[model samples]
Target: MSQPKARRSQLISTYGIGGLFPSSTTSYMIAGLHEWKEDRAEPLSEPRLARSLKVVALKQPPAGGRKDVPVIRFPYTQVCPSCRRIGRLHELSKDWNIAECSKDKQPLNPFRLILACRRGHIDEFPYFQWLHRGQGKAGSDHLMKLEARGRTSSLADLVLTCTCGVENRNLDGAIGPLADFGTCRGSRPWLGPETEACEEIPRVLQRGASNVWYPAVRSSISIPPYSEALSKFVDRHWPLLADREVVTPALLARVAELSDGKYSVDQIVAELDRRRGEEQEEDDLSEARLRSGEYSALIEGRDEEDIDADFVCLPRDVPADFDRLITDVRKVTRLREVRALYGFSRLEGAGGSESNLCPLAPTHTNWLPAIQVIGEGIFMAFDRDELARWADKSFAKDRARMLKVAADRNAEEYGHAPKHIDIVEVAIHTLAHVIIDQLSLDAGYPAAALRERLYVDDNMAGLLIYTASSDSAGSLGGVAAMAETDRLGNALAEGLVRLSWCSSDPVCIESKGAGSDALNLAACHACVLVPETSCEKSNSFLDRALLFGTRDGGNESEGIFSHFVASAVGA
Candidate 1:
């Protein structure tokens, strides 16, 4: 038989015909590298061999994969043994291709090339030999011995060992898998680099096969009731997940430890939720994209105040029976405890309160139009005909207060007080008759679950009153009083009708029209809206002055108008 190739080992020494080549086994290599077990859950390419290998070429730089984002990628060229041929690989049966290598480790300059090749055949290439000492009859052996007794090299495909003791074909890949060996060497041996070297002497070569690729003992992050494929996925991602901030390594280890050997999805999810509200939750190392304008506020997993309203954390397990998991999740996570997060208000400059309608001038300005929009949005979202039964009953308990808040806000923004007949009122009125249905939630939710956490900012609750009024044209103080009075009117309009009203300051009129002529009648929802006052009580000086702005015009009728309104009111 052709001499088997040497098993993957650091050559302690080397020699040639003249004398011998200087030694090149490494300090680090002699120390030994960490073992990585192959993902056996992945379907095996071959089921006959208990050993396969992965090799890499250290000379060639990575093509494109090694970048800012950390992703595990296979390289395409490498150094090997016996010949100068690169450990050629034919991924997916596409024509044979050169394996990839890196420059970080020289002796391993071939890197993981052979390890990537599942089949046992080394591609046609010269291998940079790692040689060791040998003895000859004269005294010392001058050259490395080539012992091919009678067998020739065959073109048969290569095979490998998996973590589960399965000998599978490693055909289209460069990474070889690790599996348990039966009887240490009892199973059928596949051809590999020679592991025997002058056993009569210093025992130069290692005695038997080793668990190459990845070592098989990982006590964390497993998908229950293992299938080869899912185990592989779990195996690959679990180590990476260990470093993630939000998905704590300890949490992963906990699941790995708790299940004895298998973890269910519910267990994983429960652990995740426990870790979520913690101040030291881990961050996702992977660059998973989020919404636009969503800032990096969840750095250590806690909001500024130690909580967040956005996305809920869930376990990172893939259970085949997810439907059942959902049932369990519902019981574990209460629906009432759900709350949608509140980051949108960051874009809204007025802070998170409805108390201040005008960020610029809270007390005197009435931004009813804005309040109206908010009301409309509220109605569309929560006031549908079939909604009350499903509405959060807790929120329903404070429904009246919610309306009052909206109204107070509307009055402040629009310069008019609000009434109980606005858009929001109309919508909630629609919801008043509907019944709640707890079963409707049984259907999978198409909407995000936001009720897990909600918060209102404490900064937007006060008034920054901006007032412009005519006190007394006769003096600045008089002008100031008149201006303040005018502002109060605007606030009422905003709070009541949800409309913007131009300032009704009579100061805008000419000096000739100063007293009564400057006043103009403005019709509002069938009633004449001027300064607030009694209809027939024009007897008061303030009422007369305010009504001066709402009388119908250029007439003997002007004088006749007030008297007629007064008599009509009395009647």
Candidate 2:
């Protein structure tokens, strides 16, 4: 059999360890990280990302050469399309080259349904139990067969039967809350013969369901100093400087000399101290802390562009039309972003309990799978004073409170931490989406290829809209070119105008709560919602009413951007 192939980047973003993918022959699941051969894969160095994940290093997914990332057959059960005889792959296959039914000599297809739990365990559906309803015991000689009535495409039309004189049953109620597929055995097939005791009830799911796998990826942008030549050199020799007992002034001086005097001993010492300080503050290193560094580097632009540097930023004048609402603009000509896969979750979003997270490796490993993409972006910082005043408005407060109530309810129902919904965050997030939608038309990239990063907090209100891909198209500079004063001003004005009315209006404009978990108001696909990949919050916490005034029952409420829109239209 020919080994299947996948891009190294896909391993981290879409199909990491334990993810399922279909090949020409059959479906397979990526093996656990332990099966990956170290020599076939190369190591990657991203200090901030490594520290955030609490790992010593990162590695690319194994590719090329003789051996690559390993995979294992999934759904063990295969059904003969002709005779409807069901059995394990080994039983049906005459040999490795042929997987034909033993009785009818027909090609076998993998069972469409599998069992999974919220705790990330997966197993083959218990056909025997479903056939007899746990009333009959199956012997080695017993055989099970699946028969479809061909009446409809629903599970109620599919029936499972056993050779024993036991009653058969349909597959109805196997996918919903009424399902009695039984408790999970905690099977971790990707990790070999390992099983843990679990009480989570397994739910029946199609092999290709989107909710089957959700990679918990954490990414960081390479910013100034960190993306500088000095930083790269220091990272290359990190092990030597990391050891305090072996380090000395002589070693520092020798390292400085090796740099051809491009860097001084004092500079190396400062960088080392900075890394040590980061290690000491590891506990305080949250997502906000990570973005804070990027925010500062972006707002305080660097003009000296080193051709070889991974990141380069130049401050641009804010468009005069938007100057009152926008504080600053930075055109990111060159940028590198590193994304690492820490873990994954099944049957839900990645924000659930730690116990629900599936390990990438069977045992502790010092490294994680990661990929880096180079891209260009445009960063815009909003006026803090103006935003603060808007957030204080009674209507904005009421809207925020309504979203918070919905978020609280969603958190309680989904078993995840509640999101802190603030008016400023929502308005900024919505603005990012609206602009991204507009940029997709003017910018060269499609909406899915573009991405948004929000920097919102007590002291920060900004967003970076960039297209980062593992391919060369990521650096086309189309996005950054839009940062030009006139272009950006026109884009902003057009975006607000487009969002002022939605195709799903009055329902859309009057929507008090909409979207998943009712976390949005006056926002839908026709207006502000963008692709899930483009949004940081999964398209949540958005309200066009907050950007443009709402009219409910003849009472008008002015929005934060209503004045700007009015001024642009000469209203």
Candidate 3:
């Protein structure tokens, strides 16, 4: 299995880190790092791969007795170009640089095609079986070969011939809506011998095609630090301190012994007392847990003196136009973020299936493979009263109704509804994009590098747009600098002005359900939509009309930010 070297950020965002991808010759699968339980003699001393996102690589010994670690292998079947015979290549021949047909001595080619279904199942192309599908002896042993009739590279020009000497099939009709490929075998080769029932017809795809795999990834921002200092200490040392029994008298004795004089029993007991109301688990990424922490962090404003702390929040005076609309503005000078890849979908958008992000597997693992990024950002805390007042307006309700209907229809078609994010959240999210774009120009960071973490729920209305990356040279401070009073005010004014009209305006602002899943109403590439990585919602639920007026012949009502724009212009 071969994979392209990608940046740590790209691995988290574009091609999933612990997900499956393909290359021309093989289907590459990345397994969770937590699953690598091999002994590490010098773990911290292990050198990181420069330029590549791969954190760990263990070599598999040539010979094995109950292999310590699972070896990654992609099975290959060979096709005889001369005799047109196809069959699985023996396991030993996997390392061969060149393979020849057993019967004809002709050079063989690695089978370049595979079968996959919308359910994310993938299997080797059924070359022999496909050519003889209708025949009674289709399952009988027969030599299969791939032959090209013409000098062209098109699928129509390629043909599959069998040694049964009677039938041959063209590669044509292997794709498209009416493709005749057989039902999906529901093979999850990446998971090793995993199979499931899939009724969807398989589609023939050349190895490494974009449609082969789509990863579903989830991420969360660490709000201050969700755990108490003692809880965090226990979590960091859980592997050593954890036991089958609860923290009983005997278990406490064992924990003290395991601590090796690092912490006394009295100290540990005190910490446990402090942990009573905290999350019991070491690694808790529950949706409710994450959202609640973030909500509290946003609503309960951080003190100005804590600006030098782990999660710095320095308040900025609101611009005159935004004084009534926004209640607080803070510069997040330091923050930590964790992104994890759990499962994936195929042939369909990952956002459509809400279940993919849920516990797809039967049981939960203690840990999920994660990448940590430390960065600087700006947070905008919206005035809840003002937000509600705007949302209750007749036009705002009408717009929300239209968006809700479209979203519901999309959800019904896709089998699950996207978690409810209100129109106000959409407004904040869209503005986040606008400012991110403007900051890209003024602050010198690429637009794709900036990320938005929306803090919106029943209790909180705010967002933090930050520069997040796993790179060593983190937090360039450009983003935090822009959060200063004068700079942030100017950035907001410019961002709104830019969102007022787009290069594709009128069409962009007026379109109903126009972007990636027909999710956007008035947003388009030229305006609010940012890189997929930058957006928390996959760039959905955005409407420029909510920020600036729907000025392109649609609802002509001024937006929530119109006061800021008007005030800026007047100034």
Candidate 4:
């Protein structure tokens, strides 16, 4: 969420969603969601979700563990100060990481130049254009050298020359609007032979800078496992289902006839009916399901037998305050999640057009880089009556208004406002962060692995925080174990206590608006914010005061967890 300065391409191996794989480190495009759908025609027994679904090269898993991924390193740009000779130090050594520059037995220094554009196009400094400038005298075999004139490291002091001894332009004014790098070659070396078309003029960027690269990622939760056996069967038999034009009764009968006893028409019709019903339910605003069908599971669903089980509710002895505020606590032992990587943006903030996923080639490509993670989580459903009453309060309304204004302004700038979560969601999200921070200390899991999934809509208000990984087998029971009745009560108390008084309190509690976009009211890095991976909203719309109280004159009475705080003191 926080765009800290660092070498982006290098760090992806260690921190990307698909954890440190070779493809993630260098490439911009990862697999998309739709690509992961059933593709059985390839004749592979076990599915290869990452490779077969991608557009470019097959992203094979590393043969070994972390040791397998090649160390991310680049050769130094060697330049001759006396003769204006320019080349990569790799020419002197076999390994680029350890290479040094030597020309005429004299050691050469590295060039501090790189080229990039506002459109996210990046490339090497155009030494050829800087030295030759379309002149016929210099040929491919010409020896190039570079010279720096003064002690002050300025571009004007840097000079370029060739073996031909022709006068070459100094590095001065080389980065201006009129200076030449030529029409961007649209090169994407990261994708291994892939290229793109870009008309942007390239600019200068120091190597290993944070602005060099930024990734765009989106995620979704797997809900209810398709809700029928026949639907699942059809999905698996996509080859048989692929050519079907529509899902009408006649088509189902024809498909059943064609299946030759593989599938029954009655079962197919039932499955189609179930799907249509679900779609209709989605359109009906009165019963709009919350994102991921989590509301359905929270309201009425039983646990399944295995790790991919949909929902399991465990009744627990809630604290007096919790009894008044929370309606149910469900320990979700297993859930499916789909994450897609569409495209990337550079320099500017990451709000690319939604249409960037169009086919790069003439023919269709069913592949996109994707990985599946199975994780366990805890879901807490707030008491609808209590939340509705709170929403009616003037203070809550005013607070929501403040957030709405901030959201509107953000939408104007970013082209889309964050999905508006009301006061109840704000309270739930703030509490979620509070719990995540405390859980990291006690749950034996890093905050990075513990992610938050918010469910807030007109009909439902809930929060689910879980541990997910790209690894085939998901997390240990470190996070989900905290959902035990006594353990959860204790963790809830501890989290509430932590939020009652932040280390940056007074300032942290009092601030009306703080954080990256001024989107937060009373939250700060000292307390409320967690790692970007854990939060859905990028740590926005958070306010500790909503859970506790404002700094100036607010007290426990003004907050949602006032009863909890009071009961904890009584104990």
| 1 against 4, candidate with superior TM-score | 4
**Rank by TM-score (best first):** 2, 3, 4, 1
TM-score of 3: 0.79
What TM-score against the true fold does each predicted structure earn?
0.15, 0.92, 0.79, 0.67
lDDT of 4 by residue, 1-571 (tens): 1112222222232223211122211222222222222232122111112222333211222222322322222213555444446776676434454433343544444556666655555466777567777676744566666766777777787778777756776887765442454676664433334557878666676554554555555445555544223444554444444443644667677767765786798877665556456545544422123353556765564555434343344444555557788777777666655453434555444443333223322244544333346687787888867888977877677778887878777767755445464888898999999989988988888888888988876777888888777543256877778877788888898888767887897888777678866789889988989998788777888988788766455454678887678667778
548 in model 4: Cα distance from truth in Å? 1.0
Instruction: Kindly report which residue stretches of model 2 are placed more than 4 angstroms away from their true locations once superposed.
Output: 94-107, 134-141, 150-152, 177-181, 247-274, 281-284, 553-557
Tell me which of candidates 1 and 3 scores higher on TM-score.
Answer: 3
Q: Return model 1's CA RMSD, one decimal.
A: 33.2
**Full-model lDDT, candidate 4:** 0.59
lDDT of each: 0.20, 0.84, 0.64, 0.59
lDDT score at residue 349, model 4, on the 0-100 scale: 40
Ranked by lDDT, the better of candidates 2 and 4 is 2
TM-score of 1: 0.15
* Model 2: how far residue 460 lies from native, Å: 0.6
Query: lDDT tens string, model 3, 1-571?
Result: 2233444444444545324444443334544333344342111110111001122321211112232223243435666667666677652244353355566766556676777666767677766656777774644556556788877888888888765665778888666432565467777655556677878777777765666656665555555433223344454444444443555777677767776776778877776554333424424435655656665675554554433334566667877656787788877777766565556676666766745332223344433344557798888888877888888887678678878878887777756764564878888888888988999899988888898888777667888888887664358999989878888887888888767879997788777777766778888887888888688787888988887677644545558876666666667
Which candidate should be chosen as best, given TM-score against the real structure? 2
lDDT of 3 at 133: 74
Better of 2 and 4 by TM-score: 2
- Between candidates 2 and 3, the lDDT winner: 2
Residue 466 lDDT, candidate 4, scale 0-100: 87
